[model samples]
Target: MPHLVILYTPNLEAQADMGRLCRSLADTMLAQRDDGGAQVFPTGGTRVLAFAAAHYAVADDSDDHAFVYLNLRMAAGRADAVKKRIGDALTACAKVHFEPLLAQRHVGITLQIDEAPGQVYDGKIGNLHALFAAAR
Candidate 1:
């Protein structure tokens, strides 16, 4: 089944603040789970992951870009809302960790959501090897 990769630009901090933002995003998603079995990426090197917010840094005179990259797994049809929910969670998270930085500019509040389809796979070793060879 295909999953999703969501990337956004939101306000973030310089040092430890990035780590704090990643955790907050995870916490927000986990709070909404009803056994959804979703995973947030890069948070401890899992499939579902979160990178340091500063990893998204883009150069702009406006200082309006702060990037947050997230990857999560879900069944085929769950992409749309999951993307929006991530945005919402990010907005909330930014308010706490990055608000003081962004409040001065006001222009940094925008979120650009980049959503992409992903894949999920499960296999036994020899069967997987056979599948790969067949594809080639």
Candidate 2:
């Protein structure tokens, strides 16, 4: 399972097209491949969620400053190189998406990938996977 969550400052809401960014990021995730050339993430298991923080404080607590934090959570069994590639792809996508905003305003964008050795209690129930499989 790979769920990419994007949290950004509210000030950039008007300037940023988050929906487009989400789709771009999801597409980036779908494009990732392992060294063996197999897909790194399952099609149906990919999810991207974005939220505009209603309350937050950035460096110096200035309203002019904005931040976008992207966290990618996935299962733990990938080579370091694979993970780095995934992170690089996603970061590059975000950077391009926010290029216009970056030029006009002060913004910070960060991407992090998280994976635990074994989740304590992970439960998922959905038919999305079957839908993707059927398409294949």
Candidate 3:
């Protein structure tokens, strides 16, 4: 399971399209493949969620500064190379998306990938995966 969560300053919402960015990042996640060319992430197990912080402070508490943070959580087992590829792809996509905003204002973009090991407890129940399988 891979869930990509995006947290960004509310000020950027008007200048950037969060919905479109979500879809773009989701597509980037879906594009990742393993060494054998198999999809690294299950199509249905992929989810992208974005939340605009209602209140926040960034770098010296200046309202002119904005930030976007992306956290990708996935099941462990992939190689470090694989994770780096995913992170790089996602970051590139985001950079392209925020190019305009970056030029207009002072902003910081960061992406981090977290792998869930056995020590981490993950609980889930969903029919989305089944639906995707059926469609195939």
Using lDDT, give the best candidate's number.
Answer: 2
**Top-scoring candidate (TM-score):** 2
User: lDDT by residue for model 3 over 22-41, one digit each (tens)?
Assistant: 99999999999999899999
- Kindly give the stretch of ten consecutive residues in candidate 3 with the minimal lDDT sum: 115-124
Runs with alpha carbons beyond 4 Å of true place in candidate 1? 1-16, 34-75, 79-83, 105-136
The local distance difference test score of each candidate is: 0.48, 0.95, 0.92
Displacement of residue 101 (Cα, Å) in model 3 is: 0.9
As for TM-score, the candidate ahead, 1 or 3, is 3
Worst window of 10 by summed lDDT in candidate 2:
115-124
Give the runs in model 2 whose Cα sits over 4 Å from its true position.
none
Model 1 accuracy (lDDT, Cα): 0.48
Q: Which pairs in model 1 have colliding backbones? A: 40-48, 40-49, 41-48, 41-49, 41-50, 42-49, 42-50
**True-structure Cα RMSD, model 3:** 1.1
Clashing pairs in model 3, backbone N/Cα/C closer than 3 A: none
Instruction: Output the better candidate (1/2) by TM-score.
Output: 2
Query: Would you list the rank order by TM-score, best first?
Result: 2, 3, 1
TM-scores of all candidate predictions against the true structure: 0.43, 0.97, 0.95
Better of 1 and 3 by lDDT: 3
Give the Cα error of residue 12 in candidate 1, in Å. Answer: 6.2
